[model samples]
Target: MSGHRKNSSDIHTPDLTSYPPSPSPSSYSSNSSSSKSSSSRNRVKGAARSVAGVFVSCFTPPEEDAHHNSSSAYGGSDAFTSSSDISGASDSTEGRRRGTARGIYATRNDSTHMKEPGSTIFTLAEIQTATKNFSPAFKVGQGGFGTVYKGQLQDGTLVAVKRAKKSMYDKNLGREFLSEVQALSKVEHLNLVKCYGYLQQGDERIIVVEYVANGTLREHLDCFNGNVLSLASRLDIAIDVAHAITYLHTYTDHPIIHRDIKSSNILLTEKLRAKVADFGFARLAADVESGQTHVSTQVKGTAGYLDPEYLKTYQLTEKSDVYSFGILLVELVTGRRPVESKRELDERVTARWAMKKFRDGQAITVLDPKLQESDANGPVLENILELALLCVNGSRKNRPTMRRCVEVLWNIRKEYKDLLA
Candidate 1:
């Protein structure tokens, strides 16, 4: 075990001496007495063997056991169930014990079970039927990774199915798909999207998630006609997004950095409540015990929203997400895309332009004209713009933590409410 080092304290050596003694031979010479004693001895041996079998099973790796049982747990479909499918089907006492044993082993190994431990495993054919064989009419959205289709399960449950692009079935994209499944399945929060389950068959990979009625925050901003998302709604959205990021950074079992935090990745419910979607580029923070401030890895994120420090050094910290959120805040206030080609060079980058306006005491220039025309809540909007500037600062050290960002937005929101009240 070159790579395997065990903690001595955690290794438990079973006490074999505690086992019951074998049944002794009967002294009586009667044939009937001898037969009964022999039967009783056989029962004792069988019981002992059962116990030994369970103990040996416990020593087997959880992932291996999960793989072995996957076919049985889910209907044996090669394209449908891999080790990733951990079903919620009812089981007997011994089956439960085996599952619990695997869970314990997984915890000891510093790995987590797939997201949604007992999520339903749908067959590829089932998913196809749900989406009308991937019809164009069912298409809801498309991204760099794949196309998302809206579909209804047989039970009338609405779901958004994300299908991986054929070209994206390569090794790198496959890893990303599994990573997203692992992250979304494990975490549950009001502002985070819920992953119902996933489908993986050969080159076809699909994720089934709860469908948010209002589509994406990007869609809202892009299609803003007039008087669509009110200033109050925008503030609420920023707060919602901030709270979600805070949860990922501090409240989870481990810090999760949503490397992609842009308007397109933030979805809205019917009430316009923001839910953070897309964990394809997310990464867990460095182990706390390791005393590492950040996890160094390859740079991967959208252009304008990416943190400059991360782009230069390839070292990712929670501040990277803070920087992106700052850009999103600007998007909420100004209704501008992160990167715009039609504008002049200095103003082409929304974050850079907003920061310049704030520095020049002309923050009003970056405010969406519609917001300015309203002639109310102007001061609150300016305060938010200032906060966004602090978030997108060139130095990561200057950016506030997500918790702090949430606090500032809440305070501004309260002030605006009081004015209206």
Candidate 2:
């Protein structure tokens, strides 16, 4: 984490007082009618307000709210809904309803306590018992926050319990844990990790989320030897991730920019469905009506996935996520890590290497050998490679919005599926 931090004084920070405006609606005109576009924007704003309000309430004392009479300082339950039920709604009506519902849920709750409707509050004893007294044997994953253990409740439901590292317990880390819980609890998306509940007892803080059986995309590409991902499978993953980011950026009332978007943070289900995980670095985008283009904040992200422009200017934007997603796209195509120091200097950075090959009319050289073996996937792969190039462009302005990325990736996925059929 220390290495990922940049010194503010050493860099020439941009004048964010009057930041650049978001791309004009004309950029998105090709996809939706103006009326639909306006409607979508309203939904996003409404959702943003809902999330923002919940975040603020997290700082208030729980005792102030009698209805939220839970003993824990920060606790609530998120109602789980079937994915089909949520996704089956007609586009326009559903979009509007989502915005209004989020706003109502946020406001309807007791303001003093951060309450996630439909989420359950787990006792420390319950979590400890589920995780076998925090035994190392049940540990499935470890990250900066803490170790994640595979736990099973009394009802036979599996879950992932993430407990903060003992040494990292402090005001800042506590805030991050609460923020992650608040953020995850507020929104329910199939592509986003589900938070079943949380535990805050004395020195311990733990988050319980749905257990994704398969490992991360990073493991599948770099470590797993069981199966080679086909071009269609890779395209499916790309579309899943694109839709997740699109939901964060456009569908919410307030757009969230996932400051870190890398392969390891992407989890896979048994069916290889991708779910975006780890929201510790997630932040709300600049208020659109404020005429601001980005949020001015300290640079926080992994070295390889960090947005170069963000590093220089310290102005985080949705395009920053786009830049990282571009690197991810390259990884999907080439089966290379975002940054490979062991490789030749010229090919060390995946995005730079892929872009150079694409420009030199040697894009095929960067294609994973396994993918190259499939003649049937060549044309669709070429289209995907082109989209990846556009996403990783040095200039954020040149990068397509997440919505556009979703549209293009979905088209490619459909084509690849047809090819398979």
Candidate 3:
């Protein structure tokens, strides 16, 4: 845990001014992955240090940094980035190629190619045929929810099939299926994983979605995809995620707090554009316009990313996701996770340590070593960590809404790009 592991980035200690809270960044699972290995876990939030030499910031919490300075959650999921994992199918070559620079799936003007919001009920036989009786080779990702496979529909449409475990379904009958269906079927954006359909027969429950070809942001962080993300790519990804979350919180008919927003849940394209996926932990947020401050509910989300206020109050709000986003921002810049249990005590909580570095005029020390230091990246990094602290403020009321995140990131990107130019 000391020496540079496969996932550990080299760092240069340099002083930076003070700040509050934390954030991290991507590299995809539609937005999270299931890489359970210790090394992979550590690499999940590696960095946004260098985008072909572009620059950024990483933070220290104002108050909470003193409370939980160690990581309680170490990894997001447990698995590898198989060419065949998560959701999606194989059929059209146009769909399978993640390398296309075309930008949108089927293009923004062509809505005809998109799947409908409703589920296209599939028979178990079709599912069996598509996945070759659920062959092990067809498997892509597996987690608490179940297994994800690559499959092809009869008409040649490709999809990623997420089949729930029998034991889990037998106990609840609907949690995963109902949750995914409720969340995925309600919205459609270029940045969100598209749900093709689902099936709930007997002990079998499956949710089929459009396959994202590249990998999860976590996998990219670990360079599991055989390439490292440039700092510019990371910025674009942050923007993509910001847009997706903004849509979920504001644009959709019903507001959704992703509840789980980490490197693992972020999926990427060959172009490396990000798409937010895995709605098993997604929840509808309380309507703030109606005078509701928060949604009173059970606490459910990835450990390290959970909002401290939500943990104390059991009142969920969109700010909860913002807190997690702040953690991810910290991860992106510092090349670390919110929790790193295997590391030395003080180094265990990535955000707190990075934030403290930022506070003590050592922000440069916390950046992902994969990136080279430069004046161009300095201010960008500072503002990024600054925004992260604002988002991860210990008080939910102090956190900016997703829309605000978009605005701030937009400014950061513009500034970074300008500096680079």
Candidate 4:
């Protein structure tokens, strides 16, 4: 989180264009008709602009029109990180606090308050009971954001409660907590994790989102529970992720950039469908009407799937997410992590090596060995790898728009199905 720590993958940061040498790395629920209504979008757009503005220290918080909401990240020799594969969050509290806007709009509402649509306001008491007083037994996941516990509400519905740490690491967890609540409150999509409610009372802050019963996409890729992911499943996952991002970029009230996009952030349902999770690090993009190309601001968190251009330039755009998505595409097909120090020196960065093999007319060699290459699957893998190369292109301008990503992925999935048929 301080100075840039160089690694084998670091070599690709300057440029990740197809010529080679560079690298890197949402959901919503809104009603169909109301969301399409021009009047509603105009109303949300005003608030969306404020959220995109910088929240620098000593900078006054903007007035609330009352709405709206709001990556690299690494560690490892085998791309070393914690057991959760979530590290590199250590930082000068002041630097992170520079973007803190805790005084922004609150989503909290007591039982007496009228319930709002799209999102809810939960009470601490209710959350405490839901989590059995934050029982360690209920723990499901943990990261820089905090611990996530599986909670069951009184209504017999299950939820994942992400409680901010009340310790030293939480100096400004409120900002992240609120940032997520704001962003999740705005959009809904099948591939996007839904926001159930939130709590931000006193030092206790939390976000309750849709609980995907199955584990993460990373876990599934690792063959968790002795289950192997097939190319068909992988293709669907790639498409699901693309559609989720497309919704954020083109269909949301505003284009919200998922600054942090990685396999670990992708949760799978019992059906193996992907649901993009974690919006604590999301940045609300300036509406397409603004004509502003990039968000000039602080360096946010990312994972091995980080965008080299965003890292080098400190100017973020939706294309940055596309860069990360490209990294993910490589991960999906190869069953390799972004960094794997255990491999040969040249092979440490999976995206680079995989693309190298593809360019050398050995694209089939890049397939995850778990799914042995076959005649029918070989062409599908090459097309996806080719798309991945385009996505990781060093220049953000060269990366396809998320909508375009969906289009390309849809075609890949279609072709694969045709081959199987």
The 0-to-1 C-alpha lDDT of every candidate, in the order given, reads 0.63, 0.64, 0.64, 0.66
Say which candidate scores most in lDDT. 4
TM per model?
A: 0.71, 0.74, 0.74, 0.76
Error of 3 at 110 (Å): 6.9
For model 2, the run of ten residues with the poorest summed lDDT: 73-82
Please, what's the RMSD in Å of model 1?
19.7
- List candidate 3 segments past 4 Å from native: 1-115, 168-173
Predicted model with the maximum TM-score: 4
- For candidate 4, write residues 1-421 as lDDT tens digits: 0012112111221121122211111022223354345554454454333332322231222322221211333221122111111011111111111111211111232222223312456899999999999999999989887899999888767889998787534334555665676677665567888677777666676888777899999999999879999999999999889888866765655568888888999999889889899997777774435446566545565546777666665676777788789889999999999888799988888887887888788998888989977777998998888778767766554555665566667777777788888
Tens digits of per-residue lDDT, candidate 1, 30-72, equal 2335455455335434433433332232222111111100111
Q: Tens digits of per-residue lDDT for model 3 on 218-323? A: 8887778567777778879988998888677755555777888899999999889999998876777775455566677656777688777676666777777887
lDDT of 1: 0.63
> How far is 2's C-alpha from truth in model 3 (Å)?
40
* Candidate 4 TM-score to native: 0.76
Candidate 2, superposed: residue stretches over 4 Å from native: 1-118, 168-171, 223-225, 417-421
